[model samples]
Target: MSKEPLYSLRMRAAQGGAHEEGGLHISGGERLGFRDEIEALVSGLLRKALQHSRGDADFINLTIEKVEPASCRVLSPLPVSTYEVADAEEGRRQAAVLLRELSVSEQAIRNALCLLGSVNNLRGAVLLDSRSGERLDTRGERGIRVSRMDWDRERYLYWQNQHPLFGSPRIAEAIALATKVAYAPGTVAELCWSDDPEYVTGYVGSRRSGYCRITRLKEQGDFSGGRVFFVEPGTFISEYIVHLERTPVWIG
Candidate 1:
């Protein structure tokens, strides 16, 4: 079977006249324009749709229809005077309910983190100590110390068991805590490790280890996973971390 088109938005402007006055025609076509904003919007919409699907076979095969600005205006005009005001209000109400449901679930948070990580251009993950402070190397030394709190090991373990199909246990655990501790609007959590040749330890015969970072956390849920976490070499996010061989040097 042919793969679905990576993009699903096609804008066909009228032959002549201002785009707004003449109005633009949008088609749910396979071709997408080269504009950065358009591409980002398409990707964000697709990601959100997929996350809502949650591995369902039907949604996996579903396609998005084109959305038009004019249609949205007609359907949800300002000043609360549009004919579709009631319908628009109902849509908003339904959306609010769904948001409440998803935001409270830990799985939704992890999925969001994953989607966010995918869109980030950065290659490395940030490291933070248990206290939510950034963990950075100083003077070429490791083992940074910070405040200690009763780490919620059980909660982390629970998240790991729940998402076996997704991220590594250790990474999942980290993400779970990060979601509750370091989370902020539009921030995403990333799992990173020291894989640089310069950072590799001769004893392990590898140059890298594992770490995690929390980035943008947002409310729109436009990303694929509910909460997204970027993964890097030597630092696998969620499920990937579980696959690595056990090492005692790195403590949670």
Candidate 2:
């Protein structure tokens, strides 16, 4: 019997003329066992991406790649400051403090946390108007999706040069995305909690504050996860997205 090829799927979608930076570019292959599973997963992902894109996406493309497992490079977790909390309530309290320290408005923090707590593991994030505390995501319940940082050549090259030091592909991508978006015009701050079932360490970040990991954002095994980006009141949504998809960032 032949061994199954390692299958991975990559996506790039954009509205109007953003091309490769269409604000949704992500890839996953990891432990997939069969080609059929890849097809099913990719189909579902594209559908979700389309819905979240609000019909402005001019195009969406899926790329399938097969590789040998031996070609992959494994690495340890990236070193970041961790704030341990005794329980979910404590975690929520600490998260509020961190977000406030980043100058995230009180109302915005309250709404963001509420959304995260109430929703299931969302594959995307919520965009909030910090000053008004209004939800800005186009899809409402579906939220808005952000990615494409791993596609930026400058950023990817930098990440590569750093090697096994940058951590898992998922976390590394998150950090890169957060750092780039932090500097984008009109952005205030970003928050994230992982959906990996047992993971409880989430982060609150801004251009000035950097990334701070907080444990117990939810109870272990709870599985709910999401992200939020708080922006200024008058920020143009399209322009803000343009920056997030097109700008290249370098981490020193």
- Estimate, for each residue in 1-252, the C-alpha lDDT of model 1 and write its tens digit: 112222224222121232234321111112222233455645643453333211211221223333222211001000101111133234333322332332323443333223333432221233322122323223111111111111233443554466454343233323322332222222223222111112111000001111212121222222211112222223323333322211111112
Q: CA lDDT, every prediction? A: 0.25, 0.62
Predict model 1's lDDT versus the native: 0.25
Give the CA lDDT, 0 to 100, for residue 232 in model 1: 25
TM-score of each: 0.19, 0.63
Error of 1 at 97 (Å): 30
Output the number of the TM-score-best candidate.
2
The root-mean-square deviation over C-alpha atoms between each candidate and the true structure, in angstroms, is 22.5, 11.1
Per-residue lDDT tens digits for candidate 2, residues 83-122, read: 8789878988988898888778899999988888876535
